[model samples]
Target: MSDLRQAARAAGTGGNGARRRPAFIITIDVEEDDAWSGSATVATRNAAFLPRFQALCDRYGLPPTYLVDWTMATSPAFQEFGRAVLERGRGEIGMHLHAWTTPPILPLTGADHRHKPFLTDYPEHVMAAKVTTATRVLEDTFQIAPVSHRAGRWMLDETYARILVEHGYLADCSVTPHISWRGTSGAPGGRGPKDYTGFPEKPYFVDPEALHRAGGSPLLEVPMTIAVRRYGAVVERARALLSRSGPARRASGRLWPATTWMRPNGRNRRDMIELARRALHSGRDHVEFMLHSSELMPGGSPYFRTFRSVEALYDDIEALFAFASGPFEGLTLSGYRARFAADAGRPPESAAGPRRTG
Candidate 1:
């Protein structure tokens, strides 16, 4: 704990003289209707959960950031939601593109699921077109130009960084390290079984050569933290195993179980807690956490096929906010960007982006 205090001091957020504000960035990837399932097409299913999220934020006097997909924005509900977010003055409306959900590849097949060429191999022109269109739509409809982003499915490559730069997106929150996404078509690479020692758990600028590296990209990768025991396994396995009886067993396996991936060997909730603790103790002040907005909705929705109920999502949201708030001061992405700009000797953070186009 003493070392952590020292680290905080060195990072410019230490001592009563320095006045450190712990920063928590919560980024939600909003792509409710773009999933592989046909039934999940209604935008309202995802929109319905927004009010509760808003209520939660209001109660906490915090602004929640919403990254809206262009396709989802076309719906009336989303348009109103976007306006509401802007009106609240607490949220940021940013782009969340699901290239796989548009045009030729949309209405996806099992094959599309197996091979996500829309994201990984699309021509630069095609990719740019998708991003531009979404950017325009959000700007036009909501009257807000989105400056932050998260790629749908976390499926991206170097091409994405170039695309974001072209589209005027300065910060990206993709790239989950210390985990593998094999067989989950279009997912990025992570540590292999033979090597697991390297990878960053916090945010940093995206390095161009990340694609070729064992862990992958540098795009300000704000990966979710994972906690593990001394034996290199997540600590929650015992509870998960114990809950494996009767309806609980069926529920755990089907309804958003804390599994890392489709593979039997996976990360657990404790993994995240451990990482969060380490970051706090190590003097690191920023902890960026994310989850799909679709998962916050009710069960049986196409967006959250794993069928975790709305209540379950609330539990996750409340717990995460409580844990992070208790340890770190929370900041919206915009707030964090401002701090970065200040550090860079540039204009004030709010003065750092392109003008709104609507």
Candidate 2:
């Protein structure tokens, strides 16, 4: 916590021009339309809804990095769409691993089978294999190696970070600040992942062993943009602190399940816009926005059940995108990583080649 505090305070001093142009990055988790069901079987039906969503991104010139899982990797339609986006230089296809679906499937007890196990629970060897296999699938499907990632459940650990770097990834956006998965539903035995309560609100080169601190690893952990309108800095910091405590987090969730996060949930467009505004005004270099592709199709997600609601979400995103795209330059996740490196006077984060175009 003290280190994160120090890092948060040390934000602007690191780079010369890093503060000159703040960026807004968009990422979508492309996966099966299971609607949070932890089942291993994948239907990939919801991918049909992505074309329209991509159209919206095109209109606003907001390039998105589609964080694909194994299911989306195998979908022919998604593959064609991803290739087209990549060829056009308008989007990136990156990996997103759902531990349960990306095989070498592990043997799990009945309880574990029912509950989605975070990669934090996987044996280091199994994690290595799953990640390698998933990465290979994306490479084969897209003919390009992916360099950006987000764990399926926001469940990241040092082991996962190490695996990502070994496989040539440059940035991972899995940490959600002012929130924690502690005591949340997870692996077979008991409670959830370690608390991310103290990670800095901005991107930092992660210490390979301890994810929360700044270090020399090439894999920069771009923490998700999470801020709520109603909660000020002090109040939100308190929420993050309390989230670290077992009884407090449980009670708070029970009493107010929806009190946290400014991720684009479409519940209120103004709230997200204001938070983005605040980030820009504060001179932060990058703001990363994320959403799951499953949420686009009606009935594919619990929060959005009707076509009307989905359309409303589209409208809200348009308004927010219009506002964000104007002042803040839009960058893909990897592109923003390059910006960070350049700001630090380091070489561009290496990719397989300049993204190939026909």
Candidate 3:
């Protein structure tokens, strides 16, 4: 705990007297429609709806980072829209790897994602190949080496973070704070997915392994904003500690953690607003909101099943933007990483964004 506190202070999360407005970042997973189905036959009709969502972000000057997957990268519809957005400087493009759908598919000892549904289930080399291939496709499609990422199926781990560092990615938005995909099948016979319980809400360089701990890696982790209401800070710290104790974890089921995400899907605007308020009060440096592109089109995602529900999501998004427009500065994922660097008294990565040198 002490080591993490020191690492965080050095990373510029806090300890300095200077105060900065918390940043807000929206990261949308741009993948094929009905992605949950894990169908090999790719479809991305949902790409047609990005401009509509971008228009809404434009209304609030919030440029989102569209995390493009292999399917979206190849979709002519998405290429057209993504090109226009980049040309107009309306948004940024980053990588989102869906292991089952991404190329260089290797047969694993266990079930494929259709049955197992975990990217960490595959070997590191397999994921490495998928990531390398995906990066090339995105660069060819958008003409910029993506510096940001969010792993598919929330399967971020030591291996995934190391892969990002190897590829020159500047930041990853895959860690869901206080959440654990533990006990889920992973790496065939290896350990389950990483547990992000007690992960920092603020961006920080991760450790060599155990991403939950602060380490010296340059690949910054921008954890998705998940908030708890009562005893917010205490609960967060305690949850982290409890994550390791078997007895405590068993007791936690009855303790009511009451976690909430800033996402618009299946949530209300007021709760989002309150979470933002609490985050600000806690001196958090950023708030991240994530949603899937499939949620934009009617009947594309299960969370948003109808046109009316999708519209309601838009309304919720508009209200969040309306609230955030005043107090927080909005940035794309890579854009915010640059800002965080500068705020920490380091040089900005670049006007466009940073590329990995190592």
Candidate 4:
């Protein structure tokens, strides 16, 4: 292990043979309901699930970070719920930019504009403008400057890192660890980013020159906890072989049981606990749990299409929290950032090495 990893492990465990405490974070992508479908419209949005989500947080004492997109930020109902959460001191508001719905909506001119809304595919200036608009709206609506951001579709790059830093964001949770959205076929009209197949699963400072690489960058990249099992290499090989064939890839996805990621509604108690154990053992101090607020409402999301499914999702979350009670302490995104800053002896905003200039 690297010195940084070793030091982090030692600090987490105290290195005195005492058991180490695991740390976990819950992050919700607060956005419109039409996320899966490319039909992102202002009129088809809802924030009705916020109350139930807040109640769940209160029940578990989990202070989650709600990464609100432009639609959610602009919705009066969502704003009211966000205000309630803030007033109750149970959550933090962060920025989540859905480039398509965000302001400065450019005219559909090319494949990039017509297809999926990958922020990196847009011009750096356009991306910056969208980010600026979204950030300003979120800050204005919540009455607090957002310190963290997560790009829609996990489509972040070095330009995004620079923009985030320019906007005073301290952390980003857009990287879904152990997985890549690159070259993956999206809905009939969309395209994803280029390959990020070898990105690290652990949280680290983004390398400014190569956003996929880990290094000393001002922004902390907190990837979602997506652990692959022992057959990860096999799964990768199969995936690569079937990359060009959609049907084959779909078949492989169904047959691949070893490729597991921790999702509230998708992962079982055993898988989540095992993933958490592996993360803690690998010297990781935090395991991030992510979900969409739309999933909390029946029919709001495909994952939870019914009230029963929503209750079941909650059951899964409750089970994971209960299982983690002994080893993991739940924290909000801002709370984790504060703790990380205290441990690093400086703020994340000042932790980057010299910026690369061309």
Work out the TM-score per prediction: 0.72, 0.85, 0.82, 0.83
Residue 212 error, candidate 4, Å: 2.8
Per residue, candidate 4 scores C-alpha lDDT tens digits across 1-358 of 2533333345374333554455678888888885775553444255877787677767776678999988888888888888988988888899998777787887443432235566765678888888888888877777887888888888787888888877877788988756666555433343446455577776676787888786665677887788766666766787779767889878767666545667765446678767766665676788887888788878887778888888888888877766554456678776776666656566544744332211
lDDT of 1 at 120: 48
lDDT of 2 by residue, 109-172 (tens): 5644458777768788888898888888888878887989999788888888888888888889
lDDT at 341, model 1: 49
Give lDDT per model, in order: 0.58, 0.77, 0.78, 0.72
| Per-residue C-alpha lDDT of model 1 across residues 325-351, encoded as one tens digit per residue | 555566677667556545544444433
Task: Predict model 3's lDDT versus the native.
Answer: 0.78
Ranking by TM-score: 2, 4, 3, 1
User: Residue 301's C-alpha lDDT in candidate 1?
Assistant: 42
TM-score of candidate 3 versus the correct structure, residues matched by position: 0.82
Judged by lDDT against the true structure, how good is candidate 4?
0.72
Error of 2 at 7 (Å): 22
RMSD in Å for model 3: 6.9
Q: Residue pairs in steric clash, candidate 3?
A: 121-187, 206-215, 207-215
Single out the weakest 10-residue window by summed lDDT for candidate 4.
349-358
Residue-level lDDT of model 3, residues 1-358, one tens digit each, is 3432332233224226654456779999998997776455567899998889999999998899999999899999999999999999988999999877788877554446445345666677877788888898988778888889999878887887887888878889899887877765544565467777878877887774887877666677898989754657877677677778888976764464457788875556888977776666555667899999999999898889898899899999988888776567788988888876665665443323334322
Comparing 3 with 4 on TM-score, the higher-scoring candidate is: 4
